[model samples]
Target: MQKTSYLKELVIKNTHEKNGANNSKKETEKIQSLLNLFSIANPNSGTGTSIDGDFGPATEKAVKNFQKIKNAAQTGVVNQNLFDLLALPIKKAFEDPIQGSNLRELIVNTAKNHLQNNPFELIIHQQGNSGPWVRSYMDGKEGSDWLWCMGFVQTIIDQASSIQGKNFKSLMPLTYSCDTVGVKGIEKHLLTRYQAARSNPSVIKPGDIFLIQKSNLDWMHTGIVIDVNGDTIETIEGNTNSMGSSNGNAVANKIRNFKTSKIDFFSIAPLV
Candidate 1:
């Protein structure tokens, strides 16, 4: 597992790139890596900067191009302002204030906030599931082994619990395995199997968890239910995209039919 090092510091401290000032190799490397990351996400911004830990012409050019696209000054420099701009997505995801009247509302709101930030898995060092969002939800561990759908759900629950002074562990265990969550839900009398859920759609509610059941005892993916109407459930899930693959690249909002999809519901009534 690779430890995610995406802008580890909230604020860049004591570093200036340009005009031959305090451009330490370490800081320059961070700036270069961030430029590469930004370029990967925003194609028209610029090409990726080499992560050679040196503030070369390529890095400066990339910075200027990025500034051009963002409509900022094209000074080809990386000062505190540029660093903050680079770290904007992360700051928005982790530090934005959420509004909700209750715990379940809070959970849904948090998931939406994450979705708004457009969290996507970055391919770092040729490794999949590598990025700051994945690490934030997966306890700083990211890699091929970190299938983060469950991690994303648990993170939303944890955040809501923290804000409400409730214990999230009581509702869901801190594990990345959908199977573990399913089994624990069953043991806790919180799980409603697909058939049961379909027979009584009213049992499924927003803020509850929906697990994509693969077999009688195994689940493949999980997410937070944001809405339930008639026969379909709207969800905000991670590790999935518009195609709804169990293992995908980004966090997304999707709709799944409970009657057609083999999904189990885990009631959060115990916490509420």
Candidate 2:
């Protein structure tokens, strides 16, 4: 999906929580959902607002609390401006400033920019992998099935390459599956198998991708290779946490030992 479409859904229509205001049901539901996303950071304002498409007292309280926390006008109202304030983090995630001279530099810098933005998957309707960030990366689809590790990587690649007027699909098919990416890498002779990477660490570079190998044919989680040192690589990966589970919640920088972990490489240097 285009950036416009990705951002378009982040909006909330009609003013809510005001007497005689046009509180459309759809807009109310959207407001409730967006408010719930804050539950991870601001528990007091983000809890127990039912997403039933109703502009009730609970939703009003949540809106006012969020406004107070943000130091905005503490009027219990929902407008486009207020919605923009609420969705600012997700909005800034897509605004890439061109800052690199090459694909590798662009990729690493783009990933770092997103890491600086601190994108987090939202917990909605008690679902883990559903949120504006997830949908933006997944091209408008988000749910349990959309494990977004590869989606996040691809989004970074797309954003960076687009700045260079290049297409990442020229390197590999745009895909959400690490296994598919691994197969493509092998077909293109671009993959450095775990043992091979361990043997010749010099082959991997910054901006390459690291795939956690489950088996010869099955690769699982993936992330951007931002920095390399000896046997360790620093990565900016999504859907992972401090524990390094592939299906984690937010984008993070992680340190991995390629010599010790069953990790493979998909080199993008050929694109340079």
> What TM-score would you give candidate 1 relative to the actual structure?
0.85
User: Residues 1-272, candidate 2, lDDT per residue (tens digit)?
Assistant: 23334575568656688443677876776677677767655666654477777788788888888888888887878889989877776667677575988889999998988887667776666677876778888887788888999989999888888888777888888778999999999999999999999999999899999999999999989999999999899999999999999998989999999999999999997667
Q: Note the Cα lDDT for every prediction shown.
A: 0.81, 0.83
lDDT per residue (tens digit) for residues 171-268 in model 1: 76678999998999899999999999999998998999999989999999999999998999999999998999999999999999999989999888
lDDT of 1: 0.81
- Candidate 2 collision pairs: 239-248
Error of 1 at 90 (Å): 1.8
Error of 2 at 88 (Å): 1.1
Candidate 2 vs. true structure, TM-score:
0.90
Q: How many clashes does each candidate structure show, in the order listed?
A: 0, 1
